[model samples]
Target: MYQPRKRGYRKDNATLRWSLPDRVFFACGACHILAYAFLERWGTPGMQALWIRPAAGQTGNHVFVDGGDWVFDYHGYANRPQFLAHVWRGARRRWPGWDATLVPLPRDVLISEQKSRGYDGLWLREPGQFLHDAMPRANAYLDRFRAPAVRTAR
Candidate 1:
C-alpha cells in the first residue's frame, strides 16, 4: 500500500532509488497524469473523472477515474465503496476538520486545471509518449492487485 506522505516531510531514503515516474506514484502533482492515463486506457463511456478536494484546509486536489462500480487512482484499483472509504480515511488523517467532496469532472476541466499549472499539455498532444512514460511504473504497482489494469483500449 502506498502511504501518503506527511505534509512538509522531505526526507528521502529508499524512495530516492526509484525512477522519477515511480516516485511520483502517490506523490504530489501526480494525480492528474495517473488518473488521466487510466481513464484514457480503460474507462468506459459510463465512467467519469472525479476531482476530490477537501472543503477546508490546504489539502491538495486529487483526481481519479470512477467507473460507477470501481475506481482507480494512483494508489491502484478498488471497488467504489472501498475506494471512498480509503479516501475518506486519508482525508481525515490529513485534515482533521475538513470535509472532502468528490466532484465529477469533464476532460476539458482537467486539461484546464493542468494548463493553469503551466503544463505544456504534452500529455494531450502526445498521448503515446504520455502513456509510455507514465503507465509502466504505475502498472508495476497496480499489477499487485488481483484485478489487472488495462494497458490499451479494448
Candidate 2:
C-alpha cells in the first residue's frame, strides 16, 4: 500500500524501486548482513561477503533469524550504494576476510517480474534458479556495483 516514489535514479549509478505489499528479493548485501541476523556473531566465520545480493518485501526487512522473512530482506535494497556500503562495512568488521571479490552469478542470470506461487507479491527470482538468476532491475544494480573503478594517473 505504501509504494513511495522511487529514489536514487541516476544514469551513472544504480537505484532500487519496489511497490510494497509486493515482495522484493535481493542478494546485494546479504553475505554481510546475514551473519549477525542469522546467527548473531557465532555465524560470522563462514559467511563470505565477496558477492552479495539483497532482496525483500515489506515482510522482507528482517534477518531470517530475526524472523521477518530471512533477515532484513535483501530484495528491498535496490541500488542504494551508501546503504550497501554500510552493510558491507559492518560485515567486513564482523568478518574481516570479506573484502568483496569477483564471483560471477552461479550461472547465466535472469531477471523477471514474475514470481513463483505462494509469494505475497512481486519478486526478483523464483526459488529454483535464484543463485544463478537476477531480476532485470536487480541485475542493473549489480552491474553498477561491479563496474570498474575509474582510475586517475599522475
Candidate 3:
C-alpha cells in the first residue's frame, strides 16, 4: 500500500518563474509579426493606411474617419478582412463624391496609439511618397468594385 504525497502552496518566486511551455505560449500570444504578415498579404491595399480617431463623447471603442463618413465599432470585427470590407462598403455608399484616386484618410490627419484606442491595425506615419506612387494602382483596384457612372443628357 502506497500513501500519496500532499502538494504544498507555491511561493511568490515560484509563481513568477515560467516553465518552457508557459514561455512558448507567451511568445505565440505576443507575436505581432504574424499579424503584420496577414495584414500585408490579405488586407485591402490602401485600407491599411487609413487613420482612425475616437468618436467624441463615446463610451467605448467607437472610431471614425473621413469626418464621420466611416465609423467602425471595433468590437464587431473578428478579423482584418471583415473590418476592411465594412469600411470599403460604407465609404462607397456614404461618400460617393469623394476623391477615389486617393486613399480615404486625410493628409493632415494625425494618428497616434492613443487616438486609435489601442486598436492594432496598420496606420501611416505620414502621407508618404509610397501613397503618391501607389495611388493609380489603388484607384484601379477600387474601380473594379465601383458602380458604373450614369450619364444624363442636358
Candidate 1 stretches with Cα past 4 Å from truth are: 1-23, 114-154
How many clashes in each candidate? Answer: 0, 30, 0
Off by over 4 Å in 2: 1-75, 102-126, 129-154
Which run of 10 residues does model 1 get worst, by summed lDDT? 119-128
Best by lDDT: 1
lDDT of 3 by residue, 30-147 (tens): 1122122223333333333333322333111112222122212212123445555554555546555322221333222222323333344333221122212222332333333322
Superposed Cα deviation of residue 105, candidate 2 (Å):
4.6
Q: Estimate the TM-score of every prediction.
A: 0.60, 0.24, 0.21
Candidate 2, residue 153: the lDDT equals: 56
Each prediction's Cα RMSD? 6.9, 15.0, 17.6
Clashing pairs in 3: none
Q: Rank by TM-score, descending? A: 1, 2, 3
Each prediction's whole-model lDDT (CA): 0.56, 0.30, 0.28
Kindly provide the TM-score of model 2 when superposed on the true structure, using C-alpha atoms. Answer: 0.24
Question: What C-alpha lDDT does candidate 3 achieve relative to the native structure?
Answer: 0.28
TM-score result, candidate 1: 0.60
* Superior by lDDT: candidate 2 or candidate 3: 2
- Largest TM-score belongs to which candidate? 1
Cα deviation of 40, candidate 2, in Å: 33
